[model samples]
Target: MLVGLRAMLCIVSIVAALPAHAGTLAFPSTGSMPVLSFSATVSAGRDTAPGTALSQAFGNAGLAVSGTDCTITQDISVNGTLVPGYTNVYQTGVPGIGVRFYITAGWNGGWTDASSSQFNKTDGGTAHYTRADLVVTGPVGGGTTSNLPSMFIKFTGSCIETVTATQTLTGSTSVTGNGCSLTTPTLAFTLPRAFSKNLPSIGATTGDTTLSLGLNCPAGVKVGITVTDAVNPANRSSSLSLAPGSSAAGVGVQIVNGATLVSFGPDSAVAGTVNQWIAGTSAGGAMQVPLTARYVRTSSKLVPGSVNGKATFTMSYQ
Candidate 1:
């Protein structure tokens, strides 16, 4: 009887040294993930209010946990530069705009602002085990912005499962209006005739002509310009197609601004348009954008009679 009693005591001690099973909390695979996205052409100029909403989206971002009862928590990290004077608003990649981010979390029972670079949400409990709608705001009129801010939120908790998860969201926007008034709305380029034998081969350019675009703008206005091919508005290539009625067959026109080949886009003053290039900011006076025009051989067989191409310009201001 004494030996049996000693053996039972040893078994109980070994069982006590084993580790206990823990719970976990994480973002669901298909549902409750944050969704913040926007794309629109807002009016050009400053917003009347600092936090004017350009767009917003609602999404249910909840966590999945193990066990019937559990405790969930979140740690916040901001990956953007916060705008001055505002806690939760950050600078959009766009120059003149700001973005606001927050969530009405189930565990907190109120709106939680994601303002600081590092923070904690230990108040989470069973109230957030299932669903929570996240709110993402895209505000405009602060400056010219090219891209909306991205979101990354992480969650951890004490549930039957022991795991950590994160949620991510992305966004975008466009701005439109009359940029600076064009003083030189029309520009004409005339190229001299080139001998086919003199041209070495296709892709060689000749007759470079220098030109300038003039504009009048208000003081402190940021300016951007876009050039579009008049013959084909959708042409995004550096070479311009010859306008109809041109007798020349194997040559095309090309324009350059400050060593960069100018690609064509649709005629629009919207900010962030393709090939939009920034001219210097205005100081309440006239500005001149210098450019160069040249003719390039587009085909191996040269048929030179008369080559003409037209292009249009659109300006945007912040």
Candidate 2:
């Protein structure tokens, strides 16, 4: 009877130990298992207003100003299933993932103003002006970060700004002495009061007046321009006062484009000739005209460079 009781106790103890051993085998006992995944998105943010005279002028000119904005978002996921031999692990074994987001912004602006005025038959005037600006903003060295794995991460970055300005002028004048009888008038050119005479100057009394033009480009951009006269000098004349019965007649100033004459008129005229030629009355007039040039980019490179060219004007008296 005692032996049987001992055997029964041993069997029960063995059965209890078997269950414990099976539980240990089903659970992971080695290293921790980690699984991670992450995703992010970047976008532009709102632009700030640029404060300057140039900005104000552009606004007055009906130009709408704009700037780029920046934004960033991130998501992270983690799972505790990366290890082998793990089956009955606890549901809360894995840790939550963390992430962060950041952003940056910058801006620039510029402009040019031009004007021309004719004073008399012997003098004229022209002027040009330009300006620019740039700006940047943000935390200089640090950015924001988020810790929540499921939420988007955001951070503000450093910003940059810049600006610039410029001015220019060109003027000319001409006079005819022989009234309407003469076919050409003496020409005079002047430089801006601030410009040095070391630059090229016009010395011809009767000929075409050529105006040199130049431009400064924006960063990463370049420009080039070509200008040609649209009128012929011989076919055009400037009108002037003339006495009745006088033979004086001709165009005053002429602008030519290729072989075609685009603009021409008389500046003065006389009624008669000298020494057996009937002396006629005299009339005088003057004009101020504005001209334009076209620019085109010849290369695809983004490096900036200046573009320069010239336009010609002819004055004729007959």
Candidate 3:
């Protein structure tokens, strides 16, 4: 059984990348550029008024949406003429590259091509937004050099009641449009009020807590997890332990699936999988995999210090 000083539980997340095919949504319109990269700009706070514009650009700040009302202006541009239709750049996907931005997890309200400025020269186009995510396509109208266009990325959506992964940014980006899943950079389990508890007999019974993982992917996507060997890999059995500098003594954390201790192989290996799940269609809503973390008692007496462990969750997409 597990014991702790306080009653806090921190979930360790490690998403495995299992690439599959949903369809094709790549950039350049013609060829496939897998090594594409671009930084996003949320020029306003997530709490800004519904339709008002913010003063400046909040470069690469993460976003959290309550509904589809929290509004903001955003500018997403690639490094070079990545944005089709810049100068004589015609749309490879359509006519002139209008751009189609795909998001991880999902979004609340929906995005619209904020066409008020004379700079928004695209005569017509499409900016698609769903409860799952957003995609800005088109501007396949005529001649233009305006690569980076302004967008109205509002957070007023009606998908889930709380902050699910479908509405959070996972910092994972691709030049290709859609098809793959979108994820948040990290799934931080709330800080436990206390990390201390009573110690149960080894190989006996103890305590456990439930946790959530944020993943928004296409239909039929599979997920896997892994843990690093930063701790004592040889001394431990099938579970992982706390790294150096933990407050609790003779204690560690282990992920459990039912009764078995989930084996988290080396740091970044995705082959020897342990805990995993598949994403259902949108009819079922977003997929935030529920997991359990328990305190592993290694010492005879329950200490009065904290019991915390750290592991980097590297989310991979197929």
- How do the residues 77-158 of candidate 3 rate in per-residue lDDT, one tens digit apiece? 2222333333321122222223333332222223332321111111122222321121222311222223332222322112
Better of 1 and 3 by lDDT: 1
Q: What digit string (tens of lDDT, one per residue) describes model 2 on residues 232-281?
A: 32223221122234232221222333333333322211111111111112
Best by lDDT: 1
Where does the lowest 10-residue lDDT sum fall in candidate 3?
Answer: 115-124
Off by over 4 Å in 2: 1-283, 298-303
TM values, all candidates: 0.50, 0.14, 0.35
- Tens-place lDDT per residue, model 1, 1-318, is 455443343444444564343544555553255555554455533312244455555555555444424444455555667666666676665544566666555453555654222223322333332112121233233334544444555554443343333334453455532246788888887777678865668888888888899998767667777899988888999899998889988888999897888888878655567888777777877988998999888888888688878888877675
lDDT computed for candidate 3: 0.36
State candidate 2's TM-score: 0.14
Ranking by TM-score: 1, 3, 2
By summed lDDT, which 10 consecutive residues of candidate 1 come out lowest?
129-138
Q: After superposition, how far is residue 74 of candidate 2 from its true place, in Å?
A: 99
